[model samples]
Target: MKQVIIIGAGPAGLTAAHELLSRAKDMFAVTILEESAEIGGISRTVRWHGNRMDIGGHRFFSKEDRVNRWWAQRMPPQGAPAYDDKALGRECSLTAGGPDPEKEDRVMLTRRRVSRIYYNRRFFDYPITMKPQTFRNLGLAATAKAGCSYLASCAHKLPETNLENFYINRFGRTLYGMFFEGYTEKLWGRHPRDISADWGSQRVKGLSVSAVLKDMLKKAAGKKQEADETSLIEQFQYPKFGPGQLWEEAAKEIENMGGVIRKNCSVKKVHTEQGRVTSVTVQTESGTEELRGDYFLSSMPLKDLVCGMNDVPSSVAEIAAGLPYRDFVTVGLLVKKLNLKNETKIRTLSGLVPDCWIYIQDTGVRLGRLQIFNNWSPYMVAKPADTVWIGLEYFCTEGDSFWNMTDRQCTDFATQELLRMGILTSASDVLDTHRERVKKAYPAYFDTYAQIDQLTAYLDQFENLFCIGRNGQHRYNNMDHSMMTAFLAADNLLAGKNDKAAIWNVNTEKTYQEEKNESGEGGAI
Candidate 1:
């Protein structure tokens, strides 16, 4: 039997294990080692006051249909409450009502709806919509200034180099400063001009400032573009219980296929010999133990993974350890009452939350993104009138002052900020709050990141050892993109004749391709 040891039981690791087991049923022995006591990595959903909530926000908006098909095969049956819309895309009927009596263990559902981004201390249509909100904020003067500056900058020329220049080229310096720069700086903890433009170009490439402006103009003039049924924003699918349900289901399936998942077991050292991974030394509840493997897949932070390797040159290890990460502090608040007056479902409420996730550009406010959980799923709360769950995501790094604060202190700080913004009136209105701190949540790309080429070069030494996922590849990946990377990695490994380096570059062409499909704009209801 061919044995494979997969490290980190995240979507990537779990998917790889599943594919391997299903393809070579009787010939593979798979073991997934997860450091946390749970199966899902960052996508894990937690419960407070008998309701499920995501640490941050997790949505199902992949452009790939195969990924959708893979999920559909594992999801619960029709009566299980799935949300599918022709206009919006995909939906799951997971509710707070309770689990399915037949497949209670396999299925978890929630009725929470989704919310949009909040900006400038006011609500605007996210994805940059044309509405009363935009006009009110920009006014005639600022709007004119923005238009003139944008055209002038476009005429002047951009170097095609850094993020600041990229945004200035597209949206102009004035709008970039007001809307884009500060929020991005806060998330990455660096000045926008210093960060490479590739980050924004890759993530926000499909979105053009010209498109937004044109769409706004058309809508303002009482005109609408021909609708394309196949845009990402038109609709999306989500797990009923939260995004974590998908992974938990995958974990159960992996175990059922004679695979073992060892949770709460942290790998202390990855032992390698003769330029190959030999065994891993893990610390469990009892003590440390060594396990051997034929092939290894890691989804942990690349820096951390390289550091954990037992036999690496000190210079190489130092270079790996030097890579930085941006951490996150999520404060989940249980509100005593349903706050929104519209009461419309969250999917249609994209601009409803004012912004799906508010960007705390004003440093005076400590919260980076304020996400309304109930909007994502009504089932996030056990009782509709009982309490509503809201997540305030604060971006910080490990050992930072905010990170060092206790959960209670962090919650207090979040609540205080809400009060300061006049969003929350009294502590009494907040029934309870919980804080979750994720270390090395996102990899930071510095101006001098190219200097750390040694780490990638060292990782390249192992042919069978694949590093993937968001943290795995140190790239900003959406759920679908992350899953795609994992899928591509497995496809390459299973084929036994492909280059892993090339597989990491999957979505580069995704931008232009998507633009061709979505050419027009739509009017608001």
Candidate 2:
């Protein structure tokens, strides 16, 4: 049997390990080396005083039926116990005969997709829906100006070279300034004009004013909605605890199938012989060890992966070294209540705004987004009925001032921002707080990103090396997108196919991960 070594136990790495074992266990023996002691990389669930925090919110909504089936196989969906959501008017999907969430611990629950943009002290529908309240929120004069700007943009288009032009072309300069400009700056720590348009195209390719209009007309005409548009997804499946639950379960299944997972192991060097990867040197709690493998699947940061290699072309190495990444920090806070009221008819355990997450478009603070853990899954919180569990996400560079701050300092700063925004009535409302920082959370699309194709071509020369996941490909991929990359990679290795085009092309199309082979396997050929 050929030994396979996979780096980083994130979605991509875990999925690749699981796929190889489940597909051809006798042909491949897998060993996963993770740098951290957690199962799911950024998708991990951080528990403090009983409440759990999903580092970055993951909504299990995919257009691929195979991916949905994979998730359902792991955590079967069931009917809601006490959260009678239909009273709120939002439609949801709940299946029966899976597992009763009230009695069973490992079950999936359907959650409503309620997200709003908090700007100017008023909540606007995310993606700027064309509704009376939206127009009223923006005064008549501003609304008219926005309409005129959109018309002018449609009449004359600018070359989409940078992210600024991409947003303006799709959303008009008026809406881009009010919505996209500041948030983009806050997210990447750079002006939108300085970033590449590739990020915008992949992220919001299907979202536009015309698209929103089409959705509104379809809804008004009582037509079926398409599943490809993720922004319009009304409901999604979530594990009982958090996203980490699914990954942990996958890891267990892998072990049960004779796969090995080693935590607290860091890959320090990628040993290459001629044009192929032969082994990897890792640093562990015990000591250093060299792991020789027939195949290597890496989900680590591409910059670090390339840097750790022995021999690489100067231009390729230079581009890899200059790759930029944005770090993330989530401050979990358990509070008594929020100052915002339940303006919608949605009934909650307490009178709270029914938002799984809120985008901080005000840009007056460093806060990037707010996540209500209770809204994601009631099981995420220790007391979903009495207390509110929230997460404040901030984007920054590693070792920066904000990232360098102590946990106490960071929590204090985050609490002050909530108080400044009037989300908290007093400091006494905060019951507890915890902070977690993640490095290389988001692969940026600037700096030497333009020459990434050359870097990938050089790396592709290694016949035994396969790159997967967001950090591996240096792309902004969602959870399902990362998993699909591994699926394609596993399919290639098992079928003795050496070309990586299908794996790399997983999310290039408008509809991500929808194309499947004739065999109904989730891959693009």
Give the TM-score (vs. native) of candidate 2.
0.94
Number of the top candidate by TM-score?
A: 2
What would the per-residue lDDT of candidate 1 be over residues 1-525, giving only the tens digit for each residue?
767888888777888888888777587799999998887777788877787767667655455766767777777522434344632222123333554343444333423222334455555444555555576777888878877888888788789678889778877787777777777777778887777776665566645567676666766798754332122244344565777778888888899999999998888888877767888899999999999987788888888788888778888877677777788888988876433343333443222332234445566676777766655555565653345567888888788899999888888999888877766778788888888888777666663354566776787677667877778877666556667777877776677744676657755664432321121100000
What is the TM-score of each predicted model, taking all chains together?
0.85, 0.94
- Which one wins on lDDT? 2
* Residue range 63-101, candidate 2, lDDT tens digits: 767778888889888655345655222211112123233
Off by over 4 Å in 1: 76-117, 213-232, 310-315, 337-356, 452-454, 510-525
Clashing pairs in 2: none
CA-RMSD of model 2: 4.9
RMSD to the hidden true structure, all candidates: 5.6, 4.9
lDDT of each: 0.67, 0.84
**Residue 89, model 2: Cα distance from true site in angstroms:** 17
lDDT of 2 at 501: 86
